[model samples]
Target chain A: MTPEQENQIRESFDHQSMMTTFGASLDDLTPGTCRISAPILDGNQQQHGFGHAALTFGLGDTAAGYAAMSVMEPGHEVLTAEIKISLVSPAKGYRLIAEGTVLRAGRRLITVEAKVFAKDAGENRLIAVLLGTMVPVKPKPTAT
Target chain B: MTPEQENQIRESFDHQSMMTTFGASLDDLTPGTCRISAPILDGNQQQHGFGHAALTFGLGDTAAGYAAMSVMEPGHEVLTAEIKISLVSPAKGYRLIAEGTVLRAGRRLITVEAKVFAKDAGENRLIAVLLGTMVPVKPKPTAT
Candidate 1:
């Protein structure tokens, strides 16, 4: 990816307050691919003290959206049109990592997928997989 | 729904820290339906100052899970196997409400769906719809 494109993705990601709330960070970026990780916190757990599926889905969705954005034209933004996720295993770990890849990039719709892994003691276990479609749109005008 | 069943659902929900972090509340419950709502907080927003898709999906998923739980046998719990969501409109509003219902209940897997609405100025607009499968499981033993 061009330096300008990388800068754009980082700037856009910085504006997402949800990522901040979850303590998620962008770990890597490349053309049509993105990786994100977040530590598992007590506030993000389900009844059984495992990482909530919402946490998994949130990270995966954002990572996938950024992957689509990476391949889009300058100043273009992407929005999720639809997403599906399957929980393959319990998320029992200290942190979660999501790797997203673009399957197809079109003028209007982009297909993306993400694999989420739970990391415990440096071991990673696959926990969930997500597939989604993103729509490219011109950035909305900022308030003056 | 029986009072015992309602109490069981409420107690189970109270154990979910993710719901507490989102400030989501169980608003209603019946034999095979559940409703949940949460205010749109600044911490849960996307880059465009709108409600994040994570918030919508979290509410919908939990509501649908609870709907499945409402009809399960005693000592049984439900976990999401897979879920798919379509964002029909931008989530721009004061709060989001998700109403979930069981489409079909079975011994192993239950089919469920949820409709999410964005509420602003006492008006509601359809924002998203979700379909999912829930698997019934015996409650895990708590730590002694």
Candidate 2:
């Protein structure tokens, strides 16, 4: 897809939706890469007063999903078939950024990896990592 | 760990701190085995209005983590090192149950499998499945 078309497709992810209810936004997207960010909020706090594990994982998956979608065909859609998010460090900060890339693309599935970094005290720390599989929807043949 | 202590630890993972927060309470615990369950909530919806993929993974990982803890010796703790959750169906339902089992227990890590099922209009649907690795923490010796 052309750069203009790719930008339009990235816009369709709707980062403001519930999956990103805590204020997530996509900053960049390309053929096989994506970057999203979210600001930490009191509402997202767990007992630890840090970003909840659930929220952290959500952000990472969103990045990975978008990364896979960027490389897929225009008519093809990608959905998570499987995923794994590992919490490496507690997320305690004002903002977090997730960078994701497509590791492999296949006919039926795509593999992606995402890493989340939290901005803390003006320093960035790796907080989480995610690996996931995205399954592409098969297009139905059009009858002429 | 003693069977009695195991019971208490299992219960702790279940008590909810908030209505939106659901947890799997330990219903049963034995060496190398554990069972827990939690209800699904709309607030946990992902971008597609289905149960969030990350939440599903967390539940699976928690189940696997606790199951690994059940079989560890006293003073040992368990943490999820890695997890893979498969989303088979849209997690539409009232409740989701995850049954976890220890597939292989090693001195350093334990492998566990979790099956997530949702009750859909009185029919059971396999919504997700998970495989996780739990790292065991050994107690440190105190200086005399």
Candidate 3:
């Protein structure tokens, strides 16, 4: 994807309300890849003082969608069809990172993978792995 | 599981932050089963106006965890270990519901399945299915 396309994707992501609710931000973007990060907040902590699994999954899922969108044409959009996430370890940290990469990009469907990391004490620890399928759809007309 | 255990599980679910963030609530609770529902909001929607997949998965995953918890001992809690969700149809609706049932309840690991439904115009449409594993753990003392 070109720099212009990347900016477009970023702009679209900004329109997603879930990102604002969770305070997640796009950290990096490249061809067929993207990363999202968020600082750990009390609102997202579970009973164990660890990051909630759903919050982690949401970040990873969004990153995977962007990774697939990074390779699509300007007039197309990507949506998640399915996803599987395995929590490898408890996520206790100052911030969380989700790095997504497209494994295969096809005409209609793109398969992607993501790795979730927790940054604590200046060290990043692997926390989860995710696999997802994203489908390209016709662009929705911009709202008036 | 007894009725007392079911009520205990319900109390725990009420404390989940994701549920509060998305306005989801526990609709029904039974032995080895649970149902969660939420009114569709713009914050949980995608570009095409369909409910976002991550929101749906989060509901289903939490229901699955509660399904397992319902069968556990009083002092234990269940946490999501892994999950696989397949979206069968686009979710367009006024309300979303997720039904979860335990497939197996072992000493430490439990397997569960959940179905997500979208209620629109007085009709319920199946949108996704999720298979998940939950691990039972000793309850952690809440921080003061």
- Calculate candidate 3's fnat: 0.41
Q: Which stretches of candidate 1 lie over 4 Å from their true place?
A: A142-144, B142-144
Docking class of 2: acceptable
Clashing pairs in 2: none
lDDT of 2 by residue, A44-112 (tens): 554335676656777788788878888777766567888887778767888889998999988788999
- Which is superior by TM-score, 1 or 2? 1
What proportion of the real contacts between chains A and B does each prediction keep?
Answer: 0.78, 0.31, 0.41
Residue pairs with backbone overlap in model 3:
none
Q: In DockQ terms, which candidate is top?
A: 1
Q: Which is the winner by DockQ between candidate 1 and candidate 3?
A: 1
**Local distance difference test scores for all models:** 0.91, 0.71, 0.85
lDDT of 3 by residue, B1-144 (tens): 777777778777767666776788998888899999987787776655677776888889988989899988876778789999998988788889999999999998999999999999999999999998999988657631
Off by over 4 Å in 2: A1-18, A39-52, A92-94, A138-144, B1-4, B7-20, B23-28, B138-144
Q: If ranked by DockQ, best first, what sequence of candidates would result? A: 1, 3, 2
Scored against the true structure, residue B63 in model 1 reaches a CA lDDT of: 94
After superposing candidate 3 on the true structure, give the runs of residues whose Cα lies further than 4 Å from its correct spot.
A140-144, B140-144
Worst 10 contiguous positions by lDDT, candidate 2 chain A = A11-20
DockQ of candidate 1?
A: 0.69
